[model samples]
Target: MKIIIISYQKILFQGNIISIIAPGYCGYFQILKNHAPLISILKNGFLKLELESEKKKIKIKGGFLQVKKNMVIIIL
Candidate 1:
């Protein structure tokens, strides 16, 4: 799936990811390829991204996320 993470300053990340773990308002949730569409409010925590054989993480204060049609967009 394709993912993009942006903040007020700049785009933090934009690329293809195998999976993602986001800090939801209630807890953490994971997104995988072909997963159902989702819209969620994020909390202050870490965002994990898996790309191929590599894994990456980013810290977020808070944000909103949308997932649709294999595309994920996160605004922080």
Candidate 2:
């Protein structure tokens, strides 16, 4: 799946990922490839991206997360 992370300052990341470990309002949540669409409130924590080429992680204060049409968009 395609992952896109954005913020008021800049576009942080865009890549193909196998999974994502996100900090949601309730708790940490994992999103995998071919997962169902979802919308969730985020919380202050690290966003981990697992890709075929590399595994990356970023710290974020908070953001909105949306998964739709095999695309994941995170706006902070």
Top lDDT model: 1
- RMSD of candidate 1 to true structure, Å: 0.6
24: Cα error in model 1, Å: 0.2
lDDT of each: 0.96, 0.93
Model 1 scores what on Cα lDDT? 0.96
Question: Model 1: what TM-score?
Answer: 0.96
- lDDT of candidate 2 over 1-76, digit per residue (tens): 9999999989999878999999999899999878898999999999999999888989999989999988999999
User: Over the stretch 1-76, how does candidate 1's per-residue lDDT look in tens digits?
Assistant: 9999999999999999999999999999999989898999999999999999899989999999999999999999
TM-score, one value per model = 0.96, 0.95
Name model 1 segments beyond 4 Å from true: none
Best by TM-score: 1
Off by over 4 Å in 2: none
